[model samples]
Target: MRRIGLCISLLVTVFVMSACESEDEAQTFADRDQETVKHTTVKPMSNKNKQDFQTLPNDMQLAIVFSSMIRVSEAFDYGIGNPEYFVRSSMTEGEADIAKENLESIQFENKQLKKQNNEAVALLQKTHNQEMSHNEMQQLKENRTAFFEVTESMIKLISQVTPKNAKKTRQQLDQLKKQYTQYSAESVKIMNSIVKKQGADKASFERHLETMLQKQPGQPMLSELY
Candidate 1:
């Protein structure tokens, strides 16, 4: 009887310890998430318009590419910057498959937001050639809100999520941002020069952009969200 009682006490103690450990881990994750807010803080992307994609820091380039891929996927479009294309072309076969799975997993967890994004895409397509009605505009706004809900997760994956190594990760991201800004100034000059010589025809510009993306194969071409 004494042995049985001892065993019961041991089990209770073990269970309590396990529960405490889980709580501690949750707190740690929460702290990490709080720190992640800083990882996301950035100068507006309007700043990117001035810089050529070539001169941006690697991480900044990837960040832009990541955002672009999300837009492409949400819009039900496919191209060099689309999520599947980026994952498949950027990683090895095995890693690419895993990344694809991860994206699906994240999308599953954020299903409602993903659904809203899909609905937004439908509305956007419907209004592509026509003026947006008030309801359409309202839907677009809701879509934007939903899109942002999952943005933190997207950044987490692209920027690296482990908080233990945050200092190193942050330093790298900062350097990339500095370089991205530097290229921004140069890009505006190039764009202005291009516009002056040749009017920005949609067809020609898209052709050029598409050719550029095709040539870059694995590189991300981030959207300006403009």
Candidate 2:
């Protein structure tokens, strides 16, 4: 009877150990599955963030290049007269320092974009003349995309206002918004000039530009203005 009792006790211990092992294995597999799902979700999101510059139509690319050029030119012009407004400010000292660093980066990028604007204009002229190569046009599109991306980043930064500087920031942004309206008008004139200069009747370019502008995230749509 004692031997029988010991045998039963051993059997129960073995069963418990086996159950524990099975549960541990199941948990390990569950952790691995979660990791795999996380990786799968993250990879596609990273890829989705990348802009497919090559997929854009050539006409649309030209309009983007023109739009970027107009914005860059307007920013430069506005900075010349309102140099104080170009300086970024923040509430805390740490944030103020960061703002300074961002402003410096923005200034550098804007200068570079300004330099490229002449090249962009030359490319537009080449495009109008039907002399631009596929490679050259593609390069223009990529450059303009980069230009707009930088400008968009700067604009977003400026649009944000802390409680300390809300009024000042709004005042600055208001001035910039007026300038943006001027930019749209100037873009229209520039596009008309380009078409007239090329003796081309493809008003489709204007339509394309309008569509692209309407898709911009924050700014008021040109269509709404009319």
Candidate 3:
């Protein structure tokens, strides 16, 4: 009986030590997994937020500037483009406030869009580490690469972007602005011609305006107003 009791005590001691070793090994594995996960987080676009515009390529930097300008243009259009009533070409305080609020919101959206684009690029760079929506993600990567590689395509894209995109990711803003200026000049010439030709047919102005819209769709609202 005494021998049986001693054997029971030894068995219990062995079981407890075995259990503790197993627990320690499991904890070690869990710690290793945590360390592996820490390496997979998204890195900042520029040195952990020390990002300077100068760090990017000159063309890329210009593109970003152009995008920002486009957003401002959109805000301007949204705020003052149309109003229910105009009191001598000025808006009511409430209307003005709404416009200002909208402009600010749009600008913030532009910043977020830019950040998303950058994040997408970063994700692509880390393709092996994560899964992505292959179709949209790959297409965006390819399209941006293709566009940036071609001077003409870049110019055309920059020229035609909605005010919002232009506000965030555009370059060659001056060139785009210059193109608008040139279009304005040409439109003036066409309008003068239309005025001369409109002496007989009142609808000729509409036809000419439509013709301009067909040629320059980017400035449709402005053309329509003219």
Each prediction's TM-score versus the true structure: 0.22, 0.34, 0.21
- Give the per-residue lDDT digits (tens) of candidate 2, residues 1-226: 0000011122122222322122222111111111111111101113434444335444544555554454444333332213224334445545444434434433544545555465455545445343434444445455455535534543554535354774576466556544443333334344444444444434555566555443433232111100
Better of 2 and 3 by TM-score: 2
How many steric clashes does model 1 contain? 4
Of the pair 1 and 3, which is ahead by TM-score? Answer: 1
- lDDT per model, in order? 0.31, 0.39, 0.29
**Most TM-score-accurate candidate:** 2
Best by lDDT: 2
lDDT of 3 by residue, 1-226 (tens): 0000011122222222322222222111111111221121222333444444434432232223222222222222222121111111233455434433333332333334344345435533332211323444344455443322332332334333443443332344333333432322232233223223323232433343334323321221211000
Which stretches of model 3 miss by more than 4 angstroms? Answer: 1-50, 84-226
